[model samples]
Target: MSAAGPLPLVGRRVLVTGIANEASLALPIAQVLRASGAELVCAGLGPTPYHGALSTAAEQYLGGAREAFESTVREHLGADVPELIADVTLDPSLEDLAETLRLRDLQLDGIVHAVAMDRTIRGGAAKPLLQVTREEFLDCMSASAYSLLALVRVLLRAHVLREGASIVALSYLGAERVMSHPYRNIGVAKAALERLVRELAAELGPTFGMRVNAVRFSPWSRSKAGGAIPGLEEAVAHAASRAPLGNADPASLGCEVVHLLRPGLGVTGEVRHVDGGYHVHG
Candidate 1:
């Protein structure tokens, strides 16, 4: 008998970021990636030196978030799966991450950019877009959109990201359309993120054989970030009813991501909708 071929992701090292908790979309994607024979390094949001001074409440919140991230990774991914603290909003933090990976001699094959935040949407309500302040707007853009470019740039400069690396960013339908829910500020950020995917793909593909793509997931309300978005529950229900395949679950989304992350694929600069054909509706 002939020898069997290796698994699609075997020997590939993939970094999955933005795993806030068990319900996070990144969790399932990481799970699928690992199952497909990829080595995983996970990063989550936490306090970084760039923050300077933090109040007691801020400290507590950050500490708690980090602890939860560690616990979740331990429980689901495994205790030995490497975990790193990263605040994508900070360039210093991103540089630190790149340095850490370089020092570890880890050359990444893929990156899952699953980070996003919107201060304009809080306490189960979204501030009117016109009412959003400059700081708030910029913060949203920095964390949700520009972080991809920043992270990739740092990795490329540090030589931590190998040529032909696959980069996937999570997006949503709100990027191009006005959702029934209040997607206001984050929607704009997602739109920018999608644009970054295309622009990066164009630049990176020919120059270094890298691929960049974004996936617009279904109206998910199980994650902490998703549940916090006002009217998302209604949006989820409405989407489930209207979508041809109901609602695409995290597992399906994971599979598609793994497909994109697979090396040697000709696909790039694509914004794929994993929302069960809901995006096709007018």
Candidate 2:
């Protein structure tokens, strides 16, 4: 046979969420998608201009989140990449995102759900699940997991998703197993996220011919979220040692995302692992 030909993502429009900085997992995924010939839109978390009137330091901190994210996108995907500010847990921002895409005459072929947050996870330590408050737990769930449902709801309402679109969410092994690092609050949220993926896959696949899946990536302790979890670096080193293929890096994660989002894959509701056989150990 001749060459395999052009990249699978040629002409596809993909919305990639969770870019806060260059170190973000979303950045790598976005880059891969773009390289595969997809048009990209990036969404970063917010302390939007409307959050208004802060001290200079606060303004710089918040503004830097957006700036860093956009710069990373531009550096890799070029100046034309759409950049949006969104708080997926908030309906208003989600609506705005849908409107933004409509105004640009874009309909998404795929979405990379990379957003996740947990207030209880700190720099040097994370609060135990026993010590987590009700409000904190709910906040974690809403941001890290339920936001997927909210995003899909709003996007569908706006008809932003194509009839047979695909979706992939980033996840971790902590969703199903206790780990060396403290995964407490967010682990529960991830379990819910995985279930939501299956439910969405089952529901959307039949009615709209869409597919949704989650990827449990190898533990890499360098990204913003990964660095927040105490002992994650140690766990990363440990996992790399035990995993049959060693630690799967962000590029590997990106490659798998491209594979999942490709047209006609027909795989849905699966929590696929990209951790190089670490998941099989247990």
- Note the Cα lDDT for every prediction shown: 0.94, 0.89
Q: Which portions of model 2 show Cα errors greater than 4 Å?
A: 1-3, 49-60
Question: Candidate 1 vs. truth: CA RMSD?
Answer: 2.0
Instruction: Provide the lowest-lDDT 10-residue window in model 1.
Output: 1-10
Q: Best TM-score goes to which candidate?
A: 1
Top candidate by lDDT: 1
Clashing pairs in 1: none
* lDDT by residue (tens digit), candidate 1, 148-267: 999999999999999899999999999999999999999999999999999999999999999999999998999988998999999999999999999999999999998999999999
Q: Candidate 2's residue-wise lDDT over 208-250, tens digit each?
A: 9999999999987788888888999899999999999998989
